[model samples]
Structures are given as C-alpha cells and as structure tokens.
Target: TEDVEKIKPEFVRSFQFENKLMPSTWIVIRIDGCHFHRFSEVHEFEKPNDKQALNLMNSCAVAVLEEIQDIIFTYGVSDEYSFVLKKDSQFYQRRASEIVSVTVSFFSSMYVMKWKEFFPQKELKYPPSFDGRVVCYPSSKILLDYLAWRQVDCHINNQYNTCFWMLVKKKGKSKSEAQHYLKGTQAQEKNELLIKEFGIDYNELEIMFRQGSLAFWQKEDKNMPHESKGSVQNSHKKVIVEHCDIIKPNFWEAHPSILD
Candidate 1:
C-alpha cells in the first residue's frame, strides 16, 4: 500500500503539465465563439450586427458573473466576451485550466438554455460552442488597457462590417467587390462613403452597435452562502448590462469598484 501510494503521485506528476495561473495578478478569461461566421450564416443573423444575438451573449455573461463569485466584470463584443476576476482572488487555487474551462462552459450552457428567449421565433438549429483562454495582467492599468483595446477593436470591426454589408445589401455589390472597394480605406473615407453612397450617417447608428456592451455589478454583491444556487443574486443590484464607452476616464471614475 505504501509503495503504491508513493509511486502514484510521482507518476501523475510526471504526466501532468503546470497550468497554474500567475498569482497576485488580474486574471482574465476570454471566450471566443468557434467558427462563428458559419454559426451566424446558418442562423441567418443580420449582417454586421444582430441585436438579439448580442443580447444573448450579454445575457450569458451576466449569468456567468452570477455563477462565479470571483468574476467582477465582463465586456463583450461580437461573438466574444472577456471575464475579469479580482486581482487577489485565489479561485480554483489559480489554476488556469479550471478558470477558463468553468467560465467558458457555463457561458456556452447559458447560451443554449437562453437561446429561445432571445430568438423566440427561430428554432435553435444547433448548439453553439466557444473556446477560452486565460491571461493575467500584473496591474489594474494594463487590465483597463486590455478592455479598452477590445472596445477599440469593436469600433474598427463594426465600422468595416457596416460598410461591407451596406454595399452588398443596398448597392448589390458582390462580396469580392465590396472587399476590394473597402481596401486601404481610412476611417474618414469610410464615413464619407457611408454618407455619399448609402445616405447613412455612421454616427447616427445605434449606440450599442458602436460601443459594444459591458456587464458589471452596480453595487457590491452581498456575499452569499455556498449553498445559494440562484441565477439572480439576492442583493438589490443584480448584474447590470450597459452598452457604454469604457475607453474614457469618466467611465472608470464613475464606477471605481470595477478596478478597485
């Protein structure tokens, strides 16, 4: 018995890889939809942006925040969402695999479970899946930058897609022609093209389409018993979703608890 026990841990250790996340850092788990371009096409999602699809993603993010006590904030755009855990959190003993897998799996599950709510008329042809990875930032500043960077990307990609789809849908341009037309186009040129060609002012588009979305607690969640298993927190403030500018100092200043 003693001999077997002695060799067992050693054998397991030999085969196992170290996947513990760095300690004392802000942990981020980003989940991206796998092959979502096809997912959207099969589902007939509106070109550029689908408000219902985005709402479904946001709802899943909120569900994850509710389920995971360590996750404090989330930002989502397109088919991806990033969950931010508290810097000092020792969730799952800082195991990278656990952090990524648990959050991402829960998100995917919620996506399926809530699919009908967001798409009441359409049948869910197939379940969607996501891939996740974990990264750590040493300080709050870099973490904020990480989120801001994603928001900027949201702006860039959304602008391009908007123009691309307008060309295809409105002007009867082929995908190839649209892609070629937008090549080497600057932001100003894109804006002008939208105005001159489509008579659409890019600035007048919906705020949610431009800014993406964020999910966070408006107030500190009262720490609940481990046995509590409700989707919604009992606290006065449940997870709130907002499509707001996270790039500015004013946003961070207003919601200090997110970084604090």
Candidate 2:
C-alpha cells in the first residue's frame, strides 16, 4: 500500500514545472479544430459556410464561457475560437496548461454533445479534437488589437474561400484551376470576381461569415419577487451572448464595462 501510494507521485510531481500564465495580464486561450477540412467533407458540411456547424461551435463557446466563470469574452470564426479571461483572474492559479487544456477539452466535449442537435442526419463517425494555447496581453490596447487581428484574418480567409468554392462548386472550374486563378488575386479583384462572374456582391454576404462571431458579458437586470410576498426584489445581473464586430471602436465603446 505504501508503494502504491508513492507509485504516481514521482511522475506526477515532475509536471510541476509547467509554466503559469502571467498575472495582471489578459489571458487568451484559443482553440482550433484539427483537420477540420476533411472533417467537414466527411460530415457533408455545406460549402463556404455551414450554418448548423457554425451554430454548434457557437453553442460550445457559450457553454465554455458559462462554465468558466473568469472568461470575459469570446470570438470565433470557421474552426477556431478565442476566449479572453479577465486580466486579474486567478483561475487554476493562472496555470497556462491547465487553463488551455480545460477550455479546449470542454469545448470539444460540448461540440460532440451538441452535434446531433445541429446535424441530426449525420453520424459523428469519430471523435473530434481541438488544439489550444494560452497567450498573455499586457495592455487593453494590445488585447483589442489581438481581437481585431483575428477579425481581419476571418474576413480575408472567408473572401478567398467564398471565391474558391464558388469557382469549384458553381462555375465548374477544377480545384487546381480555382487555386491558380486566385493565387495572385487581391481583395478588390476577389470582389470583382464575385460580382462580375457570379452576380454576388461580396459585401452582401452574411456578416457572421465575413465578420465572425463575438461573445461578451452583457448584464441583464431581473427583478425577483419573493414567494411569500408580492413585492419585487433587488435587480439580479446576468450575462448574455452577442454576435458583432470587435474590430470597431464603437463596439468597445458600447461595452465599456468589459474593460473594468
């Protein structure tokens, strides 16, 4: 029994060297699905955009934010999501590995749990996994910039994918031909291609695909009435989800309490 008790301590204690996230800094844990392209195809996801899959991802994100009390905001697009923790949070003693691993694990599990709700016709086939990392931002400005950068990436990639998929799916162009055609195309050229060739205005696409999904804590006041009496009680605050653009100053200005 004594040896059994000591069996794992030596190996387990070795993990104490894991790096902890910096205190008094923004903690961002980003998770991205592994080999999602093949996964999407195997599951018969709609090209360029899969509303059900996207909604499933957002649902998982909402679960993470709801379960992880310290998380302040989240932004996601395509197969990736980033969760922002409060700057002063002491979650899991600010352990980077624990925080990142737990968030990703929870998200992956939730995704699987809610998959049937979104795609009732498709079988899961195999388990899905996500890779995650924790990044620290020293200032609010840098944190804002980090989010803006993700939004910019979402816009660029969506535009390219829209064009590439359109060429292959709608225009009968070979995949290789589409890739070659888009290789040197700029944003303006992509816009022109969408408009002139497909009669689609790039700007008219769904904002979720172009801008991505953003989630933050918004306080809602609820007046509770005591069961014994007929009088209303004090306001109770709750958080709700919002999908919007985080790159603009107006958004940050509108949610000033987030900074506090």
Largest lDDT belongs to which candidate?
1
Q: What value of lDDT does candidate 1 attain over all alpha carbons?
A: 0.91
lDDT of 2 by residue, 55-167 (tens): 89988998998899899989999999999999999999999888988999999999999999998889999999999998999999999999999999999999999999999
Number of the top TM-score candidate = 2
Candidate 1 per-residue C-alpha lDDT over 228-260 given as tens digits, one digit per residue, 9 for 90 to 100: 664455566678899889888888999887878
Would you estimate the TM-scores of all the predictions?
0.90, 0.92
The segments of candidate 1 whose C-alpha lies over 4 angstroms from its true place after superposition are 1-9, 220-235
Q: How many clashing pairs per prediction, in order?
A: 0, 0
lDDT, each prediction = 0.91, 0.91
Residue 170 accuracy (lDDT) in model 2: 91
